[model samples]
Target: MTAFNPITISCFKAYDVRGELDVNLDNAIAYRIGRAFAQYLNDGKENPVIVVGSDIRPSSESLKQSAIDGITDAGIDVIDLGMVGTEEVYFATSHYNAIGGIEVTASHNPINYNGLKMVRENSRPISGDTGLADIRAIAERGEFVVADKGRVTLNTDKTAYIDKLMSFTDTTKFTPKKIVVNSGNGSAGPVVDELQKRLGDNIELIKVHHTPDGSFPNGIPNPMIIANQKATSDAVIAHGADFGVAFDGDFDRCFLFDEKGRFIEGSYIVGMLAEVFLKKHQGESIVYDPRVIYNTENVIAQNGGTPAISKSGHSFIKQVMRETRAIYGGEMSAHHYFRDFAYCDSGMIVWLLVIELLSVTGKTLSELVNGHINDFPSSGELNFRLGQKTASEISELLEQKYHSSNPAKNTLDGLSLDFGNWRFNLRSSNTEPLIRLNIETKGDKALLKTKTDEILAVLDECGAVSADH
Candidate 1:
């Protein structure tokens, strides 16, 4: 038996486990996490089963196998769903009646990093506040219960998962449209190929960097970064496609590009999706993040859908979606969740629904979102690298400065200050050392710019911005 090596618990984050490979995270740590997760899910029951999946990262297979070994060692049956996106693990967990699921993926991280996303039965997330802390503590302890090893089985049938994703909208209503899909050489290719095969003549799917390459020769599939978006935008322009879609490494979050080769902000997409859902199911609830709110609120109100605000993260969005029974939930970060799909976010399903909306409306992507963009012009999310002061400290100072006006404020996830005509949200990133800022003004582009600059000045005063910049 290989002696277990004790490792630091830093890889376990607020939402999922992620870190640089072989440094803060490695196969040894993965094994321990598997064992710990199994112990957590056992719940005084026998024959607890776990579904395991991995992305296309070079190190994912080795880490997955080691984790499986630890899980089986704890007498938990393992259903191996090989080489899949993170959402597939969530689907499999619910489909197979497993006690829990784990996806070995460092989603959208650099090539040198790898990690895991875990969930409990019914595809409910295991975040730090829920059960990740306990798993971290147990894994750090390195103690295991002696039990007979369990069985491991392999299953890669994604037919049901694909069918379920398509069930959100009627295919008969889909009109043929040429669209570009840039997989960014990540784990999304296989799933896209499968869905494309099912769609047949309904869409002209233009593929770019569609192969699943762990080396990420192009780059990691983070479309949020402006530099990383050129490929999708260029492809859309070159192909004259209706629109372009890009996915992260694990295909759980997706971004959009318009027919004119312009990157569309996720906030506008949220408003459009809310309208789509509400047109069919009026008075239903729609959940949105507090980052940029005017467009979503206006669209939901006009479409007769109740708007609910939630913290901006996959776990929080999914939890709030379930609590509010929201038909759809979207965040400016491009994570879209649906109540129909076990309240979990899925990149594949997002694009499919977008296609359905485009077909039903007979409008280009730009046309679909332009009205909202005009109504709620926004300064896209800006990140300030902190130097001396913490995000909370800066937030407090800004709050003091604006409190004299007695603006509507909420601290649900961060500092959301609504000044009637214009508003901004200042929040610290869950995984990084930067403070993110999002500002929006009602139909006033000039005010948007002025207020954005004003906020930057405030950040400078608060030492949230580095002095060198």
Candidate 2:
């Protein structure tokens, strides 16, 4: 048993618990967290039943066991859904009528990283504002009371989860197409294999790094980084595939590449999906993040659906979706949430819906997104490392510089300065000490480049270092 020392709060992030392993988060911390989470949900009348799942990270299994031990020690029953994606835990929590769920995963973080994502009833996340702060405090205190232990049951089957994912689309309407599915040796393999078993006849899947290996043999399973996409792009071109899809470590977020091996930004995909959902629902609300909005707003409005903007984050997006009763919600970072799926982000459902859109429209993935791309040429998210200036300092400088222009500033998630022809969002990352910048222009690639350069100059002047270093 690991000793009970106070764990650093660095692991308790805005949305979930995540940090470098051993340094801040470990089996001991996991166990303490489990006890704290159980105590939080336990009302004394009955023991809370909690669902637990884990990703393919090497440290995840032990951490999961420690958590389960702590929960059981607190007289909380646990159901272990072994080696599953984060969404599966969310699904299992609501599907089984459990009080809550916890998924052990680092989710696209470095191999040395690991963490937990917790949710309450109805798959609602437990973030800082919700329950994470309390949980963190309990864990750090390490003053858990001993009680009659509860039992744990192993139920590793993913059939129900896959069925739920398949329910989002019509398999009969799926046109036969050869595509590359890159799991990047993450937890996506088993789920993707199950999905293939259901639709193998219609979809020709070219598997790349399809095996689940916690070692992350394919360089971190994060396709958001341009270099990390090389394997998927190469496989797509080599196999003459229709398109390529890549999943993160926990398979909660997915990224896309075109048949031509060009990466498609997530903002355009959000717009495409808005149009798709609007066609079916006709007038349902669609939730989107405020970072890049023109394309999504335009498409949602044109398609007779309302576009609601929310602060960027899974917890924030899900809450907004529930409040607005939105049918769909998406972020530019590739997290897509569906109302049918308990408002939880699923990496599988988004790609499947895109495939369905492609089949119905008889258009290539590039064709589907090119119009939005041309309409809203954007500088994909650019991260600048903090130097002498802090994130707040840099943001203040940008606001001061642009304040006089009166370019329709919005301080929702960050500072969004909107000009008639071009706009930019400059926000500090919630998880990292870096400033994120996004610039987009209406039908003007030149304006996008010019504005991007102008922002880069400002960032440079504000003591920000390029991420390239």
Candidate 3:
């Protein structure tokens, strides 16, 4: 008998199921998860159908097929939406009225990785307590208890998804603007290629590394990495286009760059997107993650819309958006979810809106987004491994020390403390065994450093390093 790794059997996490491909997320485990998910959602129904989608990663096909077989074996039907992003799965599930959906994607991870994110009815996400842990536990046991097997179906080429995205906004107003898009060579290539062909040369899009190369030749599809953004920024400057846009592996999170070759931090993108969405549909509420500065709230409010601050996870943001009927939601991590897209995030949709924003505003990308260079400097999303420590342990100690006494502290996501005029959030990673921290403060750059140092000192006491883990 071969030895089994616990990480593989126990890796389905709070937000979704993720780990390295082949090692933790192999076909056998995917098969079991499919069966387990079908059983869990069906509750002994006649025939529960699920919509399955996968990105363009090489291994996605095999894993998705195995999951489909597992679900079918458990007497559930699978509607395969092949080669689509996560948002498309959400759309198919909701549109077709399936029990739930599964999207096989690793969103922004390195080339050697892959995983899955699941949702129950109404496109609601399945997380740790919500159901991921149970699914992982069932898959690990690897025992089959099914009397009748289900069926598997296929539906590729998401024409409706693409059309719906285009219909959500009035592109005519935003046309005639030359924009640059670099999709980081993930699953976004086909979608971007089609969009460029449809939009024609009038947009002057500079598509770089937008092909479906699972090898990730142009560095992983993550645009947030300074290393990955180099090509996009250079292309923007070289082509003399207005700005640049890049997508992650599954094209869910988008990062931006100005014509002057400056990376606009994602917090600004969240705020800018919020403003644009509110302007289009007057008084629509916007959802925002708690990691970045609350400037998003101010921007949405100033734009005559309500701003609802939610936790940092995509699932949390989507839930908040659905509950509040928010027009749009954005996290500082570059994930932007939309209610119009069945409460799922889409990097392509976000970039499309930004293009319209530029055309309608008639201002340079820098001019429109520069004013929001984060009045409060922040250390975006910093991850620190906690060997034997959990966020709860550190959070308990710090609450009384800083937050409880301050009385103005916020625990909406994790622990957000406001010391005088500065603020920061010390939270746990939704998917990893790491302690995540974010520090933001007013225009005073020195104060930002001091606050960050203070938090770091406390985290160090709990055996966390200041360096990225």
Candidate 4:
């Protein structure tokens, strides 16, 4: 039996665990979290097993080993999937019938940080509302039931996962087209390579930064960062590709770019995917976050599907998907969830669907999305770094200013107000210390810009600096 050593861990987040290295998270804390996760899932089960994976971060391997140690110490066998994306852990957890799974990945955080995203059986998310609080409490208490150590097995085979991805679209119908794929030197590179081999010769891929380097030689894998987008955009234009796709550190969320190197807003992609799913599964419920709604709502309504609104986080979206039996769910932040994919979001699956859409429609990526963009001109998610003001204070101030307009108001996730032809959603980010604002005007670019500027001015008055600047 291990001696009890209670230590406070501050790495636990609303959804996953994240913190700066050696400060809020370290080997000891990781070990405790692993043990806690196993204990929480054990529940009188015999020889419970857990799947573990990690991203390409420098600290991930060691942290993963420590976590595996903790799980094993709790007498839970582990299946290590080697270095892989977060979704792979999700898939493996369900694929192997494991009781739980954890992916040691900070995913687009600064190089100095690393953390874990965990899930229970059947790839169900383990957020604060579910089992994360209990796991955290167990870790903090540092007490465990004595049991014989469990064994660890190496299972790096991704054939099953690759097969699952290919099942989303028929490659036979995929027209011969060139595509620029920028992996940003993260874990996506290997997955992309494997996908390329399976894709055969019909699709030509122009790979950029397609190497897994923990040092982040190109930059952080987050294409949402304007600075990081230039690589994929430039490659798309330079190669005259059909379209471009880029993935974050863990490859869970992918960002798309048009042939003209224009970064397609995630809201528009959500609308496009909603249309795709609704066409195939008519009258089914589709879940979307309240952050950006006009385009998605319009599309779902047009396609004979019901639109179910959910909060902005993955856990909330997944729960709503299950509740509504949604055929698909999307967030403006590039997280796309599928009913068939265990209600888990996958960056790879999204791009594949986009590819199939393009092939089936025979339309340029821009051509396919242009109608939605024009009909609902939007200010794609502008983030503001708060100064001296909390998000709640700013929300109250904004409400005070806008509530007099008698617009339709909804606080499903944050503040959403619709004044007939125009609307906006102002909310705080779940992960970062920032406020996200999204606005859209019905086919009115002038109004979109004017309202965007007006909102920024009000935010400026509150000492909130634009993160884009």
lDDT value for model 3: 0.78
**What are the lDDT scores of the predictions, listed in order?**
0.89, 0.89, 0.78, 0.91
**Residue 237 lDDT in model 1?**
93
- The count of residue-pair clashes in candidate 4 stands at 0
TM-score of every candidate relative to the true structure: 0.96, 0.97, 0.89, 0.98
In model 3, where is the ten-residue run with the lowest total lDDT? 1-10
Please give the lDDT score at residue 114 for candidate 4: 98
Give model 1's clash tally: 0
Candidate 3 per-residue lDDT over residues 403-449, each given as its tens digit: 45564677888887776567778887776666778877666778878
Worst 10 residues of 4 by lDDT: 1-10
TM-score for predicted model 3 compared with the true structure: 0.89
Can you tell me which runs of candidate 3 are displaced by over 4 Å?
A: 1-8, 43-47, 141-148, 387-407, 453-463, 466-469
TM-score of 2: 0.97
| 134-203: candidate 4 lDDT, tens digit per residue | 9999999999867789999999999999999999988888887898999888899888988889876878
What TM-score number comes out for model 1? Answer: 0.96
- What is the model-wide C-alpha lDDT for candidate 4? 0.91
User: C-alpha displacement of 156 in model 1, angstroms?
Assistant: 1.5
Largest lDDT belongs to which candidate? Answer: 4
Off by over 4 Å in 4: 1-3
